[model samples]
Target: MNIVHILKKYPVVILLLLLTACEEDGDKIYLSGLEASEFILTETDILLSKENASKIVLSAAWKNNTLVVSNPDMGAPDVFTAYLQISTQEDFSSNVIETEGTGESKAYTGAELNAIARNLGLVPDVATPVYFRLRGSIGANMESAYSGVKTVYISPYLIDMTVGFILDKDKQQTGLTLASPDADGIYTGFVGATSWYNFFMEEGDGKIWGNLAADGSAFLASSEEGSWNFWYPEPGGCYYTEVNTVRKRWSAIYLPALEVSGDITGEMTFDRPNTRWYYVFNAASAGTATIRFSGQGDEYNYETGDGAPAAGKVTIAFAQENGQLVLTGAAGTISVQVPAAGECTLILDLSDPKNWTCEVTSGSEEPEPVAPEVYVIGIDDGITGGGWNFDNKLYLYNEDNLAYAGVLNVHSLWGYQIGTEKDNWGDVYTQAGGDAYSGTLEFKGQNNLAAPAPGVYLFDVSLKNLTYALTAVGDHVYVNGLDDKWEFNQTLAATSVPGVYSGSITVSGASSYGFKIYLVQNNWNMLFGGSDGKLTYGGADIPDSNSWSAGTYTITVDLVNRTYTIQ
Candidate 1:
């Protein structure tokens, strides 16, 4: 009998038995004899633009395909899956978009079509032929067939190019533009702010960027509204600025030569190795002398800041008080006396903002040159496995005071020692064995220094003072009473520079404004609070009084410098 005729004679029980037998033998019922389907386009030619981004630009539809089982006695599953594929190539070889769905039709919005066209390398504002087809599948892993291809002419739109601007501290436009060629979030351009080092950056879309603190360095930036204006230590003239919206970071590089004028005048020479500026000249008459520092082609008159060099012939110091230069000592006088009218040399060091200073030396005789020596942290005994070694170098914060500071990882009972020499076992500085973190250091102590416990520590030692201190470095720094709640809810994160931490906090208008930086989070025993830009270990509230109003601020703390800034 023919297979069709035999199926007509088979009963329900026999059909069930046949299906069970197929399953037992692990046989798949292949689908065959699929009916041809057609893919139809509602609008073959369409234009996509930003104006119609949300509107449907086109529609595609296909007829439902039908299939029959290869087994004459069995029936095929009625379930079917359809796919809409659009590609630039007629054969769908590359740059193809395939979407699977259960419906017979699909609609493409202007944004959807434009994105597809862009992905397929379609030229903008120009009609391009796009191929479309329908793929239908049935059974398990069975890709039954595909409909004939349909051609569609589509014109896509371009990404909106964005422009950025440079704004002064007062938010006034500076006529400088930062371009985003790729319409990406990053913007870059050179801005000649001249005397105006403090400024802000804004995007065409209303995004704004500024410095995190009022007295923050140029390298630090923030996009948060109401933040302080971007500023450098001194007027750096024109700068190549780059604002990255995606990363929320900005940077600027000053592009100008430095020069000095007034009592001692000359073009400053750049010491690349030392990262400083230097100028040597004879003093016409040194009686309450003043100097002005300016960048090449710069209109700003930047005066000398506080600097005192001990090794110079005549040690001079300068300080910035309310944006002006001043000289003061512990008793509010020039710490280093300026020599009588004679030849002198000036050194400008701006490499480290915390250690920014301008040192001037008098007389033709320069201080005797000495071999540069560095301090390192290591074990006490040289012969021991953990003895003195040239590792873990400390930072020299004050060149005049020979003060070195840095964080060191200490082990309990490790007997640590600070070595002046790099490799030799000479000049081993230490204190009598004890768990104390602060004490006087001996030239060659009989006992090695010991920590209370194993942990990272803040090590500050001054060879000039012959004293050493070790404080356990806390992992976090918290702002307490920022919201007038007397609580620690804001935590400052450690920045790229060690010993520096920064965070944002909001302050509400209150009868009094007070806050403190807690070395230990949520604790008051070890905290910092002070007035002006200086920080005290256990000083008073930050503002010193009720001088600040309600606003959000970025607070940065420099533990090594004992200073803090809120902007």
Candidate 2:
């Protein structure tokens, strides 16, 4: 090196010498101020749910999701962003869907960060429940799955849900019932335990329609008639039987839901507008995990077709206690008007730092049981519809209990008049013989001891609460007060006037046989005379019949004419 270059560089040595002599810039010391000892990562937990419906909510929580870096001076976190990652048990692979996309980081403050994590998509509509996961972010930093990944548990829900399932009571709460299919569902009568009744439905045309038959059953309780004669005449003695059938259908069907709730879930309600769906579902990532709700409700007014609007406001009565979100009144007891033709859904903002969030799942389908047909026949058949002719006064007495509630079947049919036509099905009434009106119960006349088959059998006996009166005539006794015509075992005949003036009647059947007699008024009314004065009905007897049965022909006095005649 040159001495000049060395002198230039050595200038600092002379400067240092001068400074050292002055003691001002003698030596320079470097020191650093206190740096933070440690940075701590505070942990936070959250849950999400739906609102409104009876269902609980959708949510899951875990404190391990966040890491604690332990910087004592580090106060509560300022910004929190959550990156949600989701996967199905089928595929553990991690990736974001296309339009379905991945969950971007959602941010929150310290206060709001400690609570719930409901996303807007958690709102329930007509859609079903789907599964997914969530991951969180802090400030501008990203947290890997190992740092913060959470799986969620969700269920079906709605704004306001109530149950109606029972079938035996006037009011339904929970029991067996046929699932309502739709507007076109028919009112079918079937045989149930309660049995012997029918249900009417308001049809589209505004008319009420009824269905009934033998072997069929109903849910409503029924009336019974005492034992009389149950018989068939062809190549037989007494063939006794008594069969029962009843069927019914409900107007509005109801179902319940699965409930879920936690501090982190929100309320769920019905009515949803879909650009396509209420919440979009993500397959690969937690694209859009959605809890859904199902079932139906309507005021006196009802809707039947599409979906409701997303922006419209729902009139929900929110109760702070239990977080009740009712579409009706505050007590949830009020009835409102339902739209004429659409499905509706209400969405709640769950992504915000609300104390709760709710996610709901819709409903699933169930299969219904198959049913059988029913039949009712013979005079006094006790049926509402079916082709029948019961004008013949030949009444039956099957050894079975009889019914006389309100009006009998016979009188109800009188309103139809002779030859009066109606649907192929006849009016309510009873018939008298074999295969008559396709009946479930048939009464067979007995001869020897084999007490008829037990349980319920078809009977040909009917009529109650009335009686037929007649003294006697010279030869034949009249019925219904009309003379000259007679019905002998279903065969028609003409007779001469009796000398006695009692109510004229035709002697039906052979004089030697014991039988039941009635002045049948239409199809439901009947009057008789005997030991009980109530009468020996159907085919069953009082063990003795000589007095009630015909013997030696005799004369009788005339009550109206004050005259007498002998045979």
Candidate 3:
């Protein structure tokens, strides 16, 4: 046949034969020693600043060190895909950032790195190290080994952070400034002269401050009486305060201070029912004398007139003479003289106005210090198992040295206070200084107390001196039930209410499951199980009859009641 005629008639057949041969030869080709070579970073170690971060670029060369062998009649694969991995951990267990494409090199912007660093828990002005590695893949299931890791040092740009306390939520006062965060990013402050203060955080030169909502925005105050109730921050909680750099405004995260109600001193009985009550306060010095009253109802309602007396309620008036205070009111005149210049409290017996008497005390003496027989109530933060609930009454037993002691497991950055009675905000005790580890304690108008870290502690409180000491202790509780597969972490916490522990769990399956509670998750010590609907300490496992059905329930174990209930 002629060449031109044959080519036209069998062109398709010839092409198929050539392709088939190539496929067979290509199938025989194999690559060995496939590995991604160590990356060539632009900078092995970097100290990133805000200014430099914007201008910096993270570039790395990704290379494959694999040996490709092919039949003489075949050729190597045309393209290879490469990937770069960056992480804060050496093992890349978490916080891993990846960049991949079909190229020999990869580049990341400074902004991208900054975001990654933040996710790694890196704070501004703190030097943190990050790791990087490269890998290559040719097909699904065929990937090169990771290359040697490289390190990058980075320090984020910092925004100014400030904290303050607003004494009254109803009225805006020039908030008391708090000490700046130390090297560890911890803020310290003292709160006195106010029953309860709302804490706030601000950024950017500390000029503007606002409230933070759950979604991290400015919280608007309502016009109602308790409109700002929801804005009250929780003590011992860590929150992120959002900032608007352009406007120099900060949406601060609010944290509540530990509140303690100081003791009430002097006993006064009235013989007649009168519409008003009065007390004369004498101060050692006369610098805008301020007198505080602790009784019932709203704090503002208990106060009357700047210098005039009010009928049917409690009232006090002060006039200065030679740096001393002479208080005059409907209850008559009282003189206050003390060695040191300070304020004093006068207990007025108005129940019988005709035969009323005044019991005076200096500022150094707490109105009603904790007494030996007084019931000592604990402060409940969520971590303690009370879930920030104060309804439960957990009283501390009296120990030696006029002290009441209890064991508590504290969560990191959490705060709490002590009180003499249940549901009484007028007699609470708070830390005297910002440092709870070593600080004097005061009652009623004081800041919340917090532990620097999380752990178990032995709280020793003395009502006589209005002081407290916390010593580390070792005591824990655990739950082992069908819901948890008889595992730990189903912990039962002590609530503010004494002798009761509460927790929630999800039970699976339709059948009943019996379990037991223990002092420790893995330990068998102090085992408690249901015995005829009652709790038996160090007893047997709860019988199958008491097994719970499939559902989510809150379990309350009452030691005082010697019973357990699933709700």
Candidate 4:
């Protein structure tokens, strides 16, 4: 029985005995004892209003109700340390402020309590109640129960200001000037009263002019009326009004009106009897115009008809010449051609009791012809291999057929659609049958076209022809195999020469693995796989009968020749 033999046999027994000895000697032991009793607070409720918040002090005092430890050797300290906690919530879950107690008393100055109220996000002039409690501790890990909760009602201070609206010398009172106790006292309240008058505020007196800051003033005007001028203390600045003709009101701000100058063109046709026609044109600098005729009217009615003339077809032509728009047409076709000056409407009074009269009415112009806008559709989902990002949008490649073409990587069964806008699904093109991909694509349909297999397929969607084609790649080729960890990430890059991609890769082990050539990395929708060293677009996986042994292989993919070699 040597020391080594004895220690190996009784290691656990020896360790337990040593721990017991140390515990008995009080080296690392703590004697269990009863906890301190709950404490009692002197005040449980307090009011901290804005009136008294600046003058009074917030204080709380607590008394220890439990019996004190009489033995000095028990390792308990006299006079327990206490902490006062203040919080906005009743449970004090967060945003709590802790204040240490001076013996049994804790005090907060008026300014301190007000800061706490503001930090709790209490609105000015609004009253909010906060909670407080005292927690006492004797030593590390020894805490007495919490004292009763106390509440403090606090309110913030608010400022008061006066606002008024002054009327101009026009003697037109826009509206009543409202004076209220709870008003926000902003300039919007004054200008919002009426749409005709512009309001401004002066510092000393309302009658004084040029004293008001331009930033502090606001104006209202009508939309139908392009520009208007109003006088405040001085002449209110001339501001273009944005008048809402529908609502018969204007915005609170002023904007300049846009001046337009251009030639106007329009057409008119007479089809019924006793029908009056009126048109207006705004000539910028007087240019030539062409008015062609197509329909004919009864020439006899123009000379004999009294009130409510009989229906007739008329041939007419209008041209801007000699600084005037002249109308030249066959007689009994039109009564007048020339129009009055100034922006006015040409009134063709066919309702005349004796004869037809045509004259200008007011001022206007015929709108110009606008060009059509072109919008490019976008490919979304797994089709683009970039998810549904609009930055990778597709465009119309062939206008004649109305076909949209873009490079896309399709999964075997994953579906996608074309959208009018990027990242927006409100308008899209889907396949017919609601769940099948056939026939033609419909707007906002439920079904989407799926790829026949996993690979990269060129998408040619023709809306005009109502057909789509998925062309596999024989040129822009890619190699996808076990070397890519069977994922899209490890695709081998190919060298482009003429019409084919050729590259070489090293096979590391003799373990069983399969690979194929693809047009896109990680895209299994279209691939080239075949037997007897022959590669075809969208064919089966290669090496049909046997697996290639571990070795470095040089491969050449010839899309022009439609062949491949491995050596």
Candidate 5:
């Protein structure tokens, strides 16, 4: 290779670099002047218009501190195809108030979408200092026409009008304060989520207000209310079918899958797990009523008329073992398990003699679906002694007491242990090496061990592979997961002193996993520390303080066989 040849190769590389120049491209979407698209808001702004629309306005001040925004057209039945968007400007990236059409918002009809976004005191609706924007599109991909902005308001923050709150379980407060800069800032003339489906809100007294939209106004303010349950989406459009005895016995549940005129079709259902809805009529009842949809757009909606009941109505949302999902508004719960495929259904329809006979009211608010508390033993009912049928739990159980609060578990298994090491039978018993933990394994639900208990206790920590211990005392409890080194089950296997449940021996094993453990005064407090366990009344390390209180105190054994232990 000659030096001249090398120089020629270098020149070729230089030429390539010169031709390759980095280019940049950028485009922005501002709701401004997009076209005459749809406009969605939660309020009509009693401050702006004399009539408080079910939803039409957004306003706030720094005083409100909290950021607030929602779908402009929430709870209206126009089927408007607008999304609740937000930004400092008309652009997409300017700090959004609402995420574009996720979850229920995606398939919401004009009214459904509006109700979701505008529901007062709901999540994603009460936040302040939010920016909002919305646009309308036709067809699934929004390929058709778009709408224009009808009215404009300026604020430090604004939430998209297309976004609204669905008054499901999480936001079921008795009376949530809708923030307002001044009393006038947030006009409640429009009914909040409570009266949204029933009445229109209008400004009445100087301070108080009343429901007014029901009288031929605000989308009929339909007396129709739907129960939140689950069933599969029937292909022939959503309809209400009464459950027969067979269906009730089989625990067959239906979920709903809804398509937002365009975009995506979602299947909706009950919040329970493995739950089924069973509506049974008494044999004496001569008639059966069914809610059917005549056409594709037809829905068994706007429940009206005081209505009449059949002979006997049995509505149940039962768990696998509980009674059928036959609910009559007494006081109970239905456990619905989310299936692996499709959607679930929960509908409330006026049956038989329609005259508003079935007046619907909200049920107990479902707590935010937190991971249920649970307990996991090294033994899984799989191995001979280790396998137990006991289920995971939310709280702890000792003996027979449940409400005592003496529970020492953040997560646990079934409490009622059914079988023995020899038989290895029954559902609650999990086998552990030939020995059974016996007793029902405490099971709350999932991983809700993040709860805190009372009194002072010790914690064990192991990171990477290093082990460390600490003593902590607090009135609250909170746990994330069971880090093997987080805490230990310290209970006495034997006792030297006799206290309240004197002969009670603080047995080893079973304490709050992850975090906090409580000291219930009356119930399991003594039982958990009962029998073989000793309650050392005035000890420095016991659950009872230097002279205790009455509440059931969760006691832990500090030493083993008189061995020198950390007191």
Candidate 6:
């Protein structure tokens, strides 16, 4: 065969014969000239950063002669495996990192190089020299050959300190975590506690951090393992907490409630994620008055800004002092103009702790009041009284409740109308056509309200919610505390009025004339007494004051209006 064809047919065998022709041991195999060759590096100096973590930072390559097997007659073997060893020591005596592959060159990314550098005890952001060497191994039983060491200067960056777990004083995880999106070492989140509690923060690297001072004077933190835990001084509520590892400082703002006091007064709802407190302010009349923001055990007075209480939106200006959002001026001195008779929304935004602001914008106004005269008009259907007459009149017995109730004998397929005026068809209320007896009430619709079934129902209408309901009426109620007996003995019969019950009871043996009303016999779940001189569900006692005198009295219980009276 020609030289080219012979070399191609048994290239490994010819190369081994030419390199190790004088060797005699049949099983011996080795790589020649590996120790004498230099290990080449693409970059002798590199600066590593988290921003370029995935980018290729360094590359290493070395040349080694082909494997030489003593017996040319043996089967030819595949390419040898190359290993890249990295170490901080010049002699590579300890802490060596080894990586293997079937190639002559190896490349590393910034993150991989940074990790290796950190593993070698190199300080972050500091440039240090590391040693690299290449080795080649032919087979499992064969000896390996290594190349000379190459030094490279590398600067590593700190890993992400963004995620940390909030642990209780017992060092147990609380399932609450804080994150620094920017990875700037500042973590923020809200925590709720039932009482005074102490907590600690454990970083993603399993390093626990706590307050530097044992007493937690200013909420400063330390990385020491034995540091004291951060604590809440006040009792039981929600708080906005922030921790800055860079500055070793921390702060917790107690936010039990946010309220607006003075001319524009109302409670504000908390928008936790946005760190905002907002409430709709209604202007009864146009005037100028000094208004203040209160809650968090302090008052926030107005400083300087044109965004005062006006007809449109106005943003109030604020500043930060000592890491807390504070009002510029003294309390009760910041006078603002109130908008004309209209509604306005007031907002206090502390989303940015350094810059706090208040904004006033247009808001919804209170709705018009509904007239108290509401009557049920429909065909009698034999069970009800007058035919096509407004005889079943619903009464708003309780002004505070703002609902009308009355009993009506309804037919399964019958339709009804709730009218404002007696015998007036023009002023009536109808709903969307349906058999859903309990639903919203429409001022005027294409169809009348359909009855759910044929039965005596306690019909109820809520003026505030613009809704209606039809509940089956119970026949009677159980009365207790009569004649000083705790057990129920007297019963009040339900009247034609939806929830009204009347009965005559003699309180002769009772030391005090007190009683409780219950819907179910021997059941306290649906019970009622008196609260603030009105019948209340699950209230303390009848008469509220518990000072009723013994006598024979006619008792009237208005369950719908939540009121009771003894005549």
Determine the backbone clash count of candidate 4. Answer: 20
Residues 316-372 of candidate 4 have per-residue lDDT tens digits of: 333334433333453222223334445654444333212334444446533332212
TM-scores for every candidate against the unseen true structure: 0.29, 0.15, 0.24, 0.22, 0.19, 0.33
Consecutive 10-residue window with the lowest summed lDDT within model 6: 298-307
**Which candidate number has the best lDDT?**
6
lDDT of 5 at 76: 17
Tell how far residue 379 is off in model 2, in angstroms: 51
Better of 1 and 3 by TM-score: 1
lDDT of 2 by residue, 125-163 (tens): 222233244333343323222222223333223211111
List clash counts for every candidate, in order: 5, 134, 25, 20, 161, 0
lDDT of 5 by residue, 438-512 (tens): 112222222211212322222221211122222232332221112222233322232332111111222233322
Give candidate 1 regions above 4 Å deviation.
1-33, 63-79, 160-179, 182-567
lDDT of 1 by residue, 142-232 (tens): 5446677789999888634466766766776755567676668787654544322457766543456776653313345677657887653
The lDDT values for all models are 0.60, 0.24, 0.46, 0.42, 0.24, 0.62
4 against 5, candidate with superior TM-score? 4
Error at 304, model 3, angstroms: 53
For model 6 the TM-score comes to: 0.33
TM-score of 3: 0.24
